[model samples]
Target: MEPSEDTSAVSPVTPPPGCPLHSNAVPLYGEALAEDDTERWERLRKRFGGLAPVKVEPEVAAWLILGYEEHRQILRDPHLFTHDGRISRELLEGRLRPEHGTYPLVNYRPNALHNDGAEHQRLRTALVDSFEKLTSTRVRAAIEDLANDLIDAFAADGKADLIGQYATWIPLLTLNRMFGQEDRHGYFLCELMVKLWNGEGAEAGAADQAMVEYLTRLISDKRRRPGPDITSWLIAHPAELSDEEVTQQILLLIAAAHDPTTHLIGNTLRLLLTNMDLRFSLAASVIQIEEALDVTLWQDPPFKTLIGRYATRDTTVAGYQIRRGDMLIPGFAAGNNDPILRDADGNPPHAQRPVSRAHLSWGLGPHSCPARGIAYQIAATSIATVSARLPDIQLAVDPGELRRRPSPSINGLVELPVTFAPQQPLARPHRAEPAPPAPPAPPAPTETVERPRTIGGIWDRVSGAVRAWFGV
Candidate 1:
């Protein structure tokens, strides 16, 4: 461990003396819809004084790392900053006496978010294989078929909400296709995902529980009658895992795959529509799709906030004095936007000629996301297919009208409205010559005023209220 620096002599910006335990909760970037102004991220940089301290729970504190070089270093050095919340959980749950003692729901540990070393490697390896199976060629081809079918239905209408019709459809249907899992559970999982990532949960405790219940049932059915699906694979290899462990991993996998892809698709639509020049550029150069994806991820990653380790021993990060047990957050959001690290003019770092400014979308070092390649490939191919097939797509609704889930962790629109000219792939237009004819112009029609009906207002309200109350 590195020796601790003197906190006393370092640049001192005293925190409020005695605020509420969670007062300095440190609103993450993009938490507040208004403050998400990306323009201000540079201004906020000066306030860090090398380290920005934040409160997670009322008493649980963590440092938000923003400096590009230091953030890179912390992510690389796994020894000093530990991801295993088992240590922190013991403190919060009063499990210091026994590691497995029950406490608040927050005290419980999940699969491998907080693990390191060989255990971490094992968990990650399993997940990598799972993802490979998830995004295989056969699975992608199935997704392509689904996308084409959905497009065919909407082409006749000339207008449809992209999120409602396509973006949401692809991911949900892809998940269903890959796992052969059903959304017979309704949009419950999607809604839960939006809430969990957004960190807006009165039922955060019950969120994972709900997933656990669903996955448990899924794993059980698969075990009884296995197939060539992901859940079946998990059942086939239960040697290193118990039934419950298998269930938990599946739940985690489903959640990870669902939200990230949803946001990636959603964000891609928003970016493409807003930047028409970039959109046209991409449409023109099909081969440039990969670079476009790299740029999109660098500019705006789907998940902006992620949890990380607390220092196990005295350590220095970004030249700030960090004591043992101080929580550290590797801010993916902040890192991607760091002006000193990226070109403010908006040139994405090329993979072939990688510079110091590569986006930390998949993260860095040991715990980096293993499924990034799959995510990129899936997102890229989906967009490429659309661009090649329908180059004239545009927003159906006003750009400002689309709403993003007001969550800091996940950044994607709740609804995205889009429109495009309808055309059948197999049908071709025929040209014909027309003869001109002389005719008088018709007079314009007069506008008519409609009478208001007031008697039915109460009846309509009562009926609407009843339907809402009963959730009809």
Candidate 2:
């Protein structure tokens, strides 16, 4: 499809004025400039509660669903809300209206994640089988090796940006392996996905060219030396799938697998250290680990605020009348945190929604991520392994000192600096504390003849050195 630069990428479809939620608020885009804005969110909630239909900015005119049940209803009933609304076809045919040129595609492809009906089912089944195959026992073992190798490289140094060193690298490498692409391209792939998913305009323009060139190279290589990897497999099994379809599917999978998994690792670590009881409980049981994932997904969803949908026909949702060609944004964070889903009777005010199965992190209904099982296994195993191995891997810096990534869709620490008393088998205390006498004595630190770095201080020095070298 020929690419064009037309500024009016999005235009609102006119709807009836009676809809109470009608708003001048622009649709949210690009890392959600309005995501953390509490007042705006509250206003949105109120409008949504009023059952008024509103046009959100930064997007074409779309209905906003504030009600939790209604959001779920929309997700479930795809007939009323279509994913085929993406403007790919018009662009490809050179018939795309100027206003639609800003979209990623002028002609929409019916990817599993963007379609319903039998087409969705068929695409999802093939993708799911391939993903499950990649997540088998052999893959888990390989991941463990990769993790240990990373730990070995930096664990002794007592300092490293866990996100850069491990989280991003592992997922990218995994996808590279899955696609039979060279290991060297993993980092490039990560960079491309981040740009395409996060930025637009001039930044997007540069990134788009780089990404296309990079992907084309990778695809070309895979075509020549076809292996049992997902890309090669898809290429071989092109029974009902076109090369274009396969490439798009692989692109989406690689991006989703890498970024969200990286954030999941960061989120898990954050929760583990901050909430001691939850960490200990999870360390003791596989089931608890799974439960912890559910709570985390609800509390801090990777796909936080932005949810996109388009109207297949003029439909009234959440008491608002939306016309055909309208768009919709479902606030995932809003719905996940809904009080109705919380367990008031529980010991703590935790979300009661079943962590074992029905969490919305993998999404709900027809477009639910087909890689749910793979995600669970990956998360569960990694969290369980780390928790069991390093029960005391607490953050070296103050909790507030850690920097979070600046994406609205995913929440994670950009650099997780941590220090641990090296893992050692638990030994019974040789000398138990004598009574409560220890509670009475608070002594001042003695002046030492020589000052040396404590394990914690050692990490600090290494951190300083790295920062100095990089001028960060």
TM-score each candidate.
0.72, 0.73
Residue-wise C-alpha lDDT for candidate 1, range 1-472, written one tens digit per residue:
1223222233323334653212444544233335653543444467664356664433345676666676788887778777764444324333122211111212223354546777667666666666666636776676665566556656777777766666655664566555656433324555444333333234543554444444555556676778777667655652365565555555555555665776687787688888777677666764366666666676667766566666778867766667665557666667776656535566535322332336777778888777676666667767766766677888777878877665445666777777778876323232121111111221222332221221111011122212211111
Q: Which ten-residue region of model 1 has the weakest summed lDDT? A: 452-461
lDDT of 2 at 19: 37
Candidate 2 C-alpha lDDT tens digits along 68-181: 686788778778776664522222223333333223322244467666777777777778767655747766765654455455555556555667666766666666656775
For candidate 2, which ten residues in a row score worst on lDDT? 452-461
Model 1 misplaced stretches (Cα beyond 4 Å) = 1-25, 29-33, 56-60, 89-107, 133-135, 180-213, 342-357, 397-402, 423-472
lDDT of 2 at 466: 22
In angstroms, give how far residue 265 of model 2 lies from its true place. Answer: 1.8
